[model samples]
Target: MKKRFVIWTAGIYILYVLVMGAYLFWWADFGVPEAYEGTGADPATFMTDRQLELSQDYSRYQSMLYFLGLPLEWIIYLGVLVFGVSRLFRDFGERVSRFTFINIPIYVLLLSTLTWVLTFPLDYARRTLSVNYGIGTQSFTGWMRDQLISFWIGTLIMAMLITVLYVLIRRFQKRWWLYAWMLMIPFMIFMMYIQPVVIDPLYNDFSRLSNPQLEEKILAMAEQADIPAERVYEVNMSEKTNAMNAYVNGIGSNLRIVLWDTTLNKLDESEVLFIMAHEIGHYVKNHLLWMLAGSIAVTFGGLYVGYRIFHVVINRWGNTWKVKGVTDVASLPALLLIFSLLSFIANPVELAVSRNAEKSADEYAIEMTQDREAAVGSFQQLTVTALSDVNPPALVKYLRYGHPTMMERITMLESYQQ
Candidate 1:
């Protein structure tokens, strides 16, 4: 029976991979637009001639393909969930109730696939669009090198973390979810600190902010906000891409504001100051801490609900999904399937919390800058540079987007200006 179950599971997994791989390739080729043509006059006026062209090209390309690519990706994810759960229950018997050696690769593959899919659009923007627009300095080879490095690094870290969690779950199978989450808090802190300081630097250069005047202005803003001023630093992001971004990252020793080199080059001194102030707002408000808390709360809640549902479903049709041990390799698909379903149900709660935080940040940015026009212009520039959808579908945005739409941001700024 075990051998037969293994054969069926292998077949299903192979089919799932083939179908999803084909969909990905198809979306990349046909779903996206090849170029962008918009009303912004004289690329030289707004950005470098090469940068302007590249921006337009990416915008066009993305707009063309987004709708098609997004839906297909979601469908593929659902398919994986369905087949994975089915196989898990069939292969592992009662021993699956314990966390075991079975299905480790399956979980890893599911995680890797999800990560790759979610980040692919961003990666493409950074590599292909940013380069074509003249904002990215990295070659295709360089981008590929970065991707490979990130993949290995991510795999190693996640493997260690998952292994530890799996072991803990085996020991405390009855209350594993709660204990795992307790472990996650420290893990998250470690990730935030090391991710930027160590992992990110592997892909891009990190250095002290070079411009003293600009640095002072940012420090002054941080002081005005009553936050630590010494944590601001610059990273050589322009070495890879022209997309401008700033964020506050880490806890304690890891805490700092990282500014992309491209952001400094593109925005004037005041614009840079305003952007830094906005990021400082996140720190002042303790947005990161609250966000982490919210995520943990939701994850634990979901796991609790999932644990009850899994037992109930198995009681009725335990033989159908083939779930044996909670720790078994076969059981992974069942766990993932349940988790995805729970996440889908909890989507609105997650979106509302994220949207609220983003809106708060936007308000903070405007208040700090007191220059509505600069804020508005910055919003527009960000939309254009990032090739972001100005007006995405409401349902799609609700399901996927963490930030408010471009138009929503502009509208908010316009009201503030009035």
Candidate 2:
């Protein structure tokens, strides 16, 4: 059984390599259209020699850590099952409370804490690299505080999800996946509905956009776009990082436009308006609904596939792993491992869809604002401030980027003006 787990791990790596190679050597081979070729606003022109070098170095190092960390995480899940660590966790949880509901949270917290500890080195290394690059602003103590907050929040969510999942698994057996999927539809919507008002406030302070003039302009634009938003909100993010960002979040009444203070402070009025227009473009095009629909569809497929594979693996090795059945809290690692693999497989597809939606929004922003210069400047500023790779490797763009690359966006904007 342990040998089989090793083989499965090897197979996952092989799949990752094959997918990466295909993107690098084949799918990513296409060139920019000739119409966009003469854009004098090349990425090279946006940054000094030192800035360009720093950007490339940062990207390369970050990419390496990301790629390495993902597989290491999978292995941690595998290790728990193979080494009976998950069973020990389950036993400890049972000792803490006989009630399955109570025990589930205990087990989840234990697992979460273990993973958190094990993964801390990687997380800390990433943070250290960011700090060295002058991108991360949090103090070491503050960073750890955030990590603790994340752990508790994550544990609470995981516990609730696992408690419900096991209940459905026990009650519905083979059909548990369908029931879970059905329940998830509402839960996802509820999370989206509350995130802007509830979950987001935990991390940063949000208030109505301070610049009344800018807020009025944004609201007027939103009204023109038929957005329901009455006012724009700005979050205090400068204390956390220097990177600028803005987005539209939530659903229905909870739906609102949020700007990071970093964005408001760094960008000129025109660039900021263009950014807001791009966010408004998302609402105008109903991209959120579209994305939600896509997620529901992909999740349906993934959960169903994971359900099938979970049963097969459990049937073969349940006893060996000391996991009594799918209902066993000890079986959590198996479920997570299966889902993690599936999620990794689905990531590129998800990111590709997101890229297309973002491109559409970019076009809409340009159409709405009719200010190509502002759009171009915003993208350039974003790239510079974030130290983002303007033209990252094809594999990175395909697998990692959820939006069009900075270079791609600028080129399109420059071409649009022509």
Candidate 3:
């Protein structure tokens, strides 16, 4: 059974690699455009010839990292499962549980902690690359401090989740996944509600926008969107990154529109307003609610798939894998591995939904502001300053990208009548 399963997975993996390689070769732009042909004369004016060259170089470098780091992370996870590292961790946790009242918490903590340690090197490497490219400026000590905070916070959350998951598994048995799916809706909302106030400030300092003129303009835009404007935030991301960004996050009273100082410093007034309007569009259109609903639906479907696969795989090789049952802590890595593959295959569907949401926000921003030039110019700036891949490979776009390509966004804005 084990041998057959291994052979089957290897065959699927080889086929996957071949298909992706062909897609990259044929669809990934072999050469990027040297100059812009967007709205106003000389979008190239925003970037010097030297800057343009550097942007392409940076884009290629980062793309290479994505190609390398992404597959390697999954490979490492699969390796851990194949080598019984999860069984070893489960044994350690069971030993620890002898001293504690609950085995699930101990097991979850150990599992999360071990996986985190294993993954940290790659995480650190990616951050190092960002810093080397002049994108990130956080000191190693600061970075470590943030990582520690995040590690603990994430571990606590997962512990709670795993405890509940186990409870569901034991009580509902066959219907556990459905119950977990139902629970996810409110759980996700609660997490989003707390994130702005609790999680975000652990890393970056957040303050009210200091520029009163700019703040007033943003407030006005929020008012237009009918979102609350009293508490806009500016994260001190300038200390950590050069990338410009803004987002509307949180639920209900906790909701906030946060701007990175990088955006303030880099973009002009019109461009900033357009960006803010886009974020406001998300809030005004109730995109968070819609996305949450979509996620709940996907969660139900995915959980069902996981439940089915978990039983099938375990029944075939449970003895070989040293896993007793679905509820056993030792089975987590297998379950996770199944979900990982499911997510990879489901990437295109998820990305399509996200890209559509982004497009809706883009259109909303344009309609509200009626500034085609500013809308197009804002994205053009992102392509230059942020090294956003303007024309990624079709395969990369499907598998990796969450938002529309910068060129697609710029072209969309330029072609818009209203």
Candidate 4:
């Protein structure tokens, strides 16, 4: 018997991914090492013996944890459609059919449940490595509870989206994709605005900034940036992770600059000031808003392309996959499969835009603070602490990096001689 075309196509894509990853990591194009990116000097002299050991260990473990599942995540997700696993869930969705409202939820719930189950092993392994590396302190039960909470939230969103999606498909089968894209614009913005308040707190405890001195410095930056001083907040991340980070997230009243507790405890005052300035740069330049626009563009394009391919796909494999039409809940896997591929293809464009914004933010930070020393010191400390890839391969930077590499940031900072 001849094998299915999707089976062949999926296998080909998997091989392509493996080959591409191998070439990027090993053979095709290399990046300048951080040491070489600077003035001619012994890289060994840059780090103390102890610093070298810890930095290498951190990089080794972090690299393993970060990149290990890049291929497997897509492989398993696509394999479900290529094999018949998706149809199994779709079959169950059909069997559980009831009122439109309950039926859509049932379909979403089953699809999500299967995805979560299949990917749980990767999630668990990553969490285990984090705990082993002293990166995460949350207990297994606590972790599982967080996962359940996230799963519930995701299922809820998908249920609503899927229900509306099918409704659009049934009502306007020809132009459903455009209507879906239009609906997503406002819905996405609303979600971004509300996420910090409603969804974020379910996982971490957030409070008004407590450190009087640090709060003062943060507010001063906010004043210069013209962001409201009241927007500064802090999260108790020490209970969960040892990593240090701060970000300006959300929109409007939901908007705030959040500092991780680990950052406060670990970084010096000057370093924190620089970090805050960088985040403030984001707010000053309205980066979050711009990125939201970027996201919408990517979504619109992905949906359009997915919509084009979806009908052709269903026409070919609809019966085999138990999918009747675009309106059918069983078509969820086909929809997701095409969207995921479009997303993967569009990632480089998304990341390139992000990296440029980050570089611009770095410049804005220096301009805001007028403290080049503090800014450079902050990057040096962050690089060692996070074991950041100072010089990941060129392809990796193009495809995966959202921020300029540590060396790139530091190299640019050196231009601001006092």
Give lDDT tens digits, candidate 2, residues 312-387. 9999989888899888889999899999999988999899989999999999999899998888999989988888
How far residue 121's Cα lies from its native spot in candidate 3, in Å, is 2.8
TM-score of 3: 0.89
Provide the lowest-lDDT 10-residue window in model 3.
36-45
Q: How many backbone clashes does candidate 1 have?
A: 21
Please report, as a residue range, the 10-residue window in candidate 1 with the lowest summed lDDT: 30-39
Show how many residue pairs clash in every candidate, following the order shown: 21, 0, 0, 0
lDDT per residue as tens, model 4, 164-228 = 99888889978999999999999989999998889899999999887877898789778867887
Best by TM-score, which number? 2
Model 2 worst lDDT run, 10 consecutive residues: 29-38
How do these models rank on lDDT, best leading? 2, 3, 4, 1
| Candidate that scores best on lDDT | 2
Could you tell me the C-alpha RMSD of candidate 2 in Å? Answer: 3.4
**Alpha-carbon runs more than 4 Å astray in model 3:** 1-27, 30-45, 98-101
Q: What lDDT is obtained when candidate 1 is compared to the true structure?
A: 0.64
Which regions of candidate 1 are displaced past 4 Å? 1-137, 311-323
TM-score for each of the candidates: 0.72, 0.92, 0.89, 0.88
**Per-residue lDDT of 392 in model 4:** 62
Clashing pairs in 2: none
